[model samples]
Each structure stands twice: as C-alpha cells, then as structure tokens.
Target: MPKIARINGPRAAFLRRFLPLLLDFDKGDKPTGQVTNEKRKEFYDCTTRALVLCFGYENTLGNDSPGDLWDTTYDEIPAANKMPKLPEPESIERDTVIKALTPVVHTWYKNRRTEANSPAGRAVLTQRQVERTVQAFAPLAPPPKALDVYQREFKQDYIDAFAALWAKKLEAAGTDEDALKVLKRQKGGKERAFAAMRWDQESDLKKKEVVQRCKDVYADVVKRHKSLWGSPHDALPNSRMWSAISFHRRSA
Candidate 1:
C-alpha cells in the first residue's frame, strides 16, 4: 500500500537544515540507505522513513483501535500531550554510526560557535540536518485548536527507532525542545487555554547564538552543495527539506 504522506511543517524545515551530514558521497562506492539525485523521490523516502521511525509507523498507519477509524486523523495528536517513546532495535546499536555522525552534527554546531558563539553553530546547515531535527521532534508547541488535545495510540517500535536518532542529541543538550529554544532563540506563545505548554527563557546571548547557528548551517549547506539548487523546483521553497516549516507559504 502507498502510505500516507503527512508533513510536519516545522520538522520538515529542521531536516532541510541539518540532515545533509548523513549524506555521504563516494565517487567509487555506491550510496547506501536513502540516496538519490532525484530530489523529490529522495526526500519523500528519506523524510517519510525518518518520520515513521521517529514518530512510529503504527501510530501513523496500521489498523485503528477497535472501531475508532473515524476518529483517527493528524489533528488528534497534539492534545494528547504525547512525548514519544522509542521501540526496540532490530539490530545492535552500533557506536560507530553515532561516533561518525555526531562529529558532523557537533562540528556543524561548533563551527557556528567558532564564527560567533553568539549562535553556536555553522554559518549554514545542510538540508538533512534541518529536516531531521524538525522531523525528529514530537510536537512541543501547544495546539492552535481546542480539540487537538485527544491522544493517538502508538506502538513501541516507532519510539525506539526515533530514539536511535535522538538520544544523543538529548543527552548533549537536555530535551529537544530546550535545545531548539536555546539554540534557535525562540519562544512559545502564552495561551492560557493550552494545557501542554512549557515556559522557556531567551537570553540575549543565547538568542544570538541560536540564530547564528541556524544561519551558519544554512550558509554551509549552500556552499557545499550546488546541485541542490537547479531549475525552478530546486530551491528552498519547493524542496522536501522545507516541509517542516509551517509558516512557509510556497505552493507545492
């Protein structure tokens, strides 16, 4: 079956900025995992897979509980105040993947810190980095609507898969929400009607650092990958990398 394609605007934006580090190009060796020159297909598979693992395929797919099929929809997720729980790994959790990949993520941040510590990451980030970050997140922001509070059922398998990519990030900087706010210099709105909201502080220096980090990463990715920019369809607005940016107004 063709699984549904559900896009989280903010998360898609996050992945566009950072997940590129995961793309290892070899002139001689063929690319493994998700890699393609056809950007749309590449993004669809990569973004969907990443989301399915992080958010859980079962929650997004599979049969609904009892006769509750009519109630299952994307809007039902936010109200539940659901923090993701990862599932068990099918294979050994190799330290090498973490060891190899973290440096790239850390370096992306470190480069920004070096340039200005004001933001604390590179001048720009890769597409993968940005999208993956957003995709990896379980929604922390309060729902815009009142009925969005109901919780959706999820299986443990998705939780573990999502964790495989997130545990290191959390350990390095507390929670993902905290890290994003600290690193991005952003804040949630004060809506009394929303029960799941959490308060975050934004320091002058931290805000600068967060913006700088994101900016730097964006700049870096552009510098390294020229192919990502091509015909009209290849720019930021239309790319899968931008899918998570809820505020983006580009038509598909």
Candidate 2:
C-alpha cells in the first residue's frame, strides 16, 4: 500500500468525533479522506458539504456541534481531502430542498396565512410537531428575506436533501453496500433507527418510497420552480403564493 497521507491539528481532531462516523476517520492507516474506494470518498465530500451547509461548520465544528461551516478554517483546513465549499442560495440541490419544504410549510401555517400577514421572522407555527421540526433546525432559521437569512434556513434542509440524493446515488453505484450502511447509521435515533431497520427489510420499491417521501421533497412539486431556481436570482422568487417548492417572499 502506498503510505496514506495525513493531516494533523484541530481538523484531525474534528474528523474523529463528528456526527456521521464515516466522516470520522483520520487516525487509522486509511484516514477518513482515503477510505478505500471512490464511493466512500464521494460520501465524504457530500457529507462534509452538507455538514458545513447545515451546521455552519465555519462557526460550529469546535464548539458543541456544527454552527456554520466556513470557506476556511485556521487549526485545520476544511477543504482538505477534496471537500468542496458549499454553494449558497444558487445551489440547485439546496434550493430544491428549501423549495420542496415551502409548500408543506405554507400548508402548516394556512391558519396563520388566513389570520394575518405574519412576519416571516416570527416562530409562527403553533403546533408542537411543526414547531419542533422548525426549531430543531436552530442556528439555522430566521427571516430568510436577505441572503444571510436565506443561508441560515438552507443549512439543515441542504443536508437532508444531500442525504436523499446520495442514497439514490449509492444504490445506483452498485455493490458498495458499506457506504449505504454507514449513511444509514448516521441517522441514529429511535424513529430514524426504526426507519432504517424497516428499510433494511423492505423491498427495493418500498425503500425508494421511504427515501423520497420521507425527505419531504417531490420532484412533482419542485418542477414548477425550475425556471426561477435554475438561474439563482429572485431571493427565493414569487411574491404572495408559493409559486415555487421551497420558500416564497413574505411580509418582512
């Protein structure tokens, strides 16, 4: 074996303890960067970008968890190991995630919609379930009228969408089953664990459905936004109604 290249310092320490364990390699002979084959390497890139986008790795990596991942880091170079910088509002996959979520969010707040023009900044959602979904995405939600605001909201959604896209990608890539297993393991929790278990036992068709429906993204719903989302202007596009899949401008 050609000796594996290594990186040390804070980034090295970070690779060891992050959420998805697959991305958690840097000590062993094959550091997380050089994980055997190209597929896992692809997993590394996808997961890291998603992490930076979702957690704001730029701000969060060393503290409690991911806050905001930056374009650069001091202790350890984040872009090392072939990782790519996360794109912003213009990111197609990220935009797809937010757009897909917008319709559902509107439906959840329809009562509010009918009541008054609630400022997009307020908690807005009353129900616990909806509130939890919105809140659990903390350090990542605020009035998304500006690019900075739009950025915070997109982080978590961007991560989910990346996972959804990667699952399909891995399945299509052939028998590198290990990568899929690692991806599944990262979703640890009673609910997600149960879902992962069921996925393991289900038919291929069912698995596909779980991945698609669960991600809350539907190509059918988002196809409408292709024209607006394709380029990147518009600040989430549309004025009143949800003319797109993710977010439409509201009273700000």
**Which has the greatest TM-score?**
1
lDDT, candidates in the order shown? 0.34, 0.37
Query: Where does candidate 1 stray beyond 4 Å?
Result: 1-49, 53-58, 62-200, 224-252
Please provide TM-scores, in order, for all candidate models, with all chains considered together: 0.22, 0.20
Output the worst ten-in-a-row residue range by lDDT, candidate 1: 186-195
**lDDT of residue 214 for candidate 1:** 46
lDDT of 2 by residue, 1-252 (tens): 111122223433343233223322323466434444453444445434443343333232332343334312222233333233243533455445433333333232334333323565234322322433332333422221222222232234234545565557667757767866665445323223443444455576744544544233234223333333343344322311223333434432
Q: Report the C-alpha lDDT of model 1 over 13-62, residue by residue, as the tens digit.
A: 33334244333232215443244334323333333333333333333333
Could you tell me the lDDT of residue 181 within candidate 2? Answer: 65
Error of 2 at 54 (Å): 5.8
Model 1 scores a TM of 0.22
